[model samples]
Target: MSDVKDRVLDAAVDLFARQGYDATSVAQVISRAGVTKGGFYHHYASKEALLYEVYGDLIARQLTALEQILARRLRPADTLRAVIGDLVGSTAASAQRALVFWRELHRLGHERTEEYRRSRRRYHDAVQQLIADGQATGEFTAVASPEVVTFTIFGVINELPLWYRPDGRKQPAELATELADLVLAALEG
Candidate 1:
């Protein structure tokens, strides 16, 4: 992305997360980004487009990470650990964007919303499949259904932005490690 486009996105995410999608205007985004209206239009077709980009970009990056992790072909437990670590770390790193995106997701148009849902479902399905595979192979105990376990892990990740603090004692890596440990322990039982 061009410097101008990056600025617009950063500004959009910050403003949208703070004021909200409905309350924010293109003019405010342009002003905060320090770019001209023309520059903003050059990158995004509309304010709605910007909103989509904010969350879209985050999910895109996450999807890329997921693919890379899967490519390693690690054992199921290791893969699950990597997935949890990546999810928690990324969510903590982009808490504001995550918070705003989750809160205002319904504001997106039907098509864009479906697109987001599909992306999320891919991630969800991958984790669930990993759990199912482990259980089937007897590598992991079937203490809980894969669906429930997947939801349990994701539930904590989704709520992380609410209490996660950048300035807090634990770094994202540390938190990820601890979270992965807990989930792995439950799965192993």
Candidate 2:
């Protein structure tokens, strides 16, 4: 993304977080972004486009990361830890965008919502499959179903935005490692 587009997206996230999607206007986004209507339009079709991109961009990046991790062909448990760390770190890095997008997700049109959900499901399936593979190979315990394990991991990550603070004692990477340890222990023990 160019500098202008980055500003527009960031401003939108901040505004949407503070005022909500319904309450925010295109003009306010332009103003907050310090860009002209033409400039904003050059990057985004409308306020709705920005809204979608807030979470859209984040998830897209995550899906790309998932691909790279898969391409490395690591063991299932190693892959799971990498996936966990990637999600935790990325969500924390874009905390405001993640929070705002999820809060305003219901506002998206049915088509866009489905698209987003598809991408999310892809990620979910990968993680669940990783756990299932590990269990099948006797690398991970079968104490819990893959669905349960996958949801358990995502549940913590999805809630991070509610409580994460930049000034917190633990950095995102540290948090990621700790989370990976816990999940791996449950699976590997």
Candidate 3:
């Protein structure tokens, strides 16, 4: 994205998180972005498109990170830790956008919603598969089903925006390490 487009998206996420999607307008986004209507229109077709892009861009970056992590061919425990770290770090960095996206996800149209679901499912499936493989190889204990383990790990990550604060003592990497330790311990037993 161009600087203008990034500005527009950032403004949209901030406004949408604060004022909400239906309450926000294209004019407000453009104004907050410090761009003209023509500039906004040059990038986004409508406010809805900007809303989708807010979450879409985040997920796209995450998927790329997931691919890179997988390519490293780390041990199952190491890979899981890396994945958790990536998720927590990225999500904490963009908590506002994540909050807005999750709260207003239902407002997205069917096609865009499906696309979002597919991206999320891809991440979910990869984690679940990793757990299953670990169990099969005796690298991780089958204390819980892979499905349950996957959901549990993601449940914490997905809800982080609700309680995580950048100003807090715990940084993203610290939290990621703690969370990964907890999950890895469970998997070990």
The clash count for each model shown is 0, 0, 0
The candidate maximizing TM-score is 3
Task: Return the TM-score for each candidate structure.
Answer: 0.96, 0.97, 0.97
Tell me the tens digit of each residue's lDDT in model 3 across 72-141.
9999999999999999999999898999999999999998899999999999999999999999999999
Candidate 2 lDDT over residue span 14-34, tens digit each: 889888899999999999999
Q: How close is candidate 3 to the true structure, as a TM-score?
A: 0.97
Show where candidate 2 strays beyond 4 Å.
none
Best by lDDT: 3
Candidate 1 lDDT over 1-189, as tens digits, reads 799988998998898888889999999999999999899999999887888887788789888999999999999999999998999989998898888888888889988889989999999998999999999999899999999999999999999989999999999999999988898898897
| Deviation (Å) of 102 in candidate 2 | 1.2
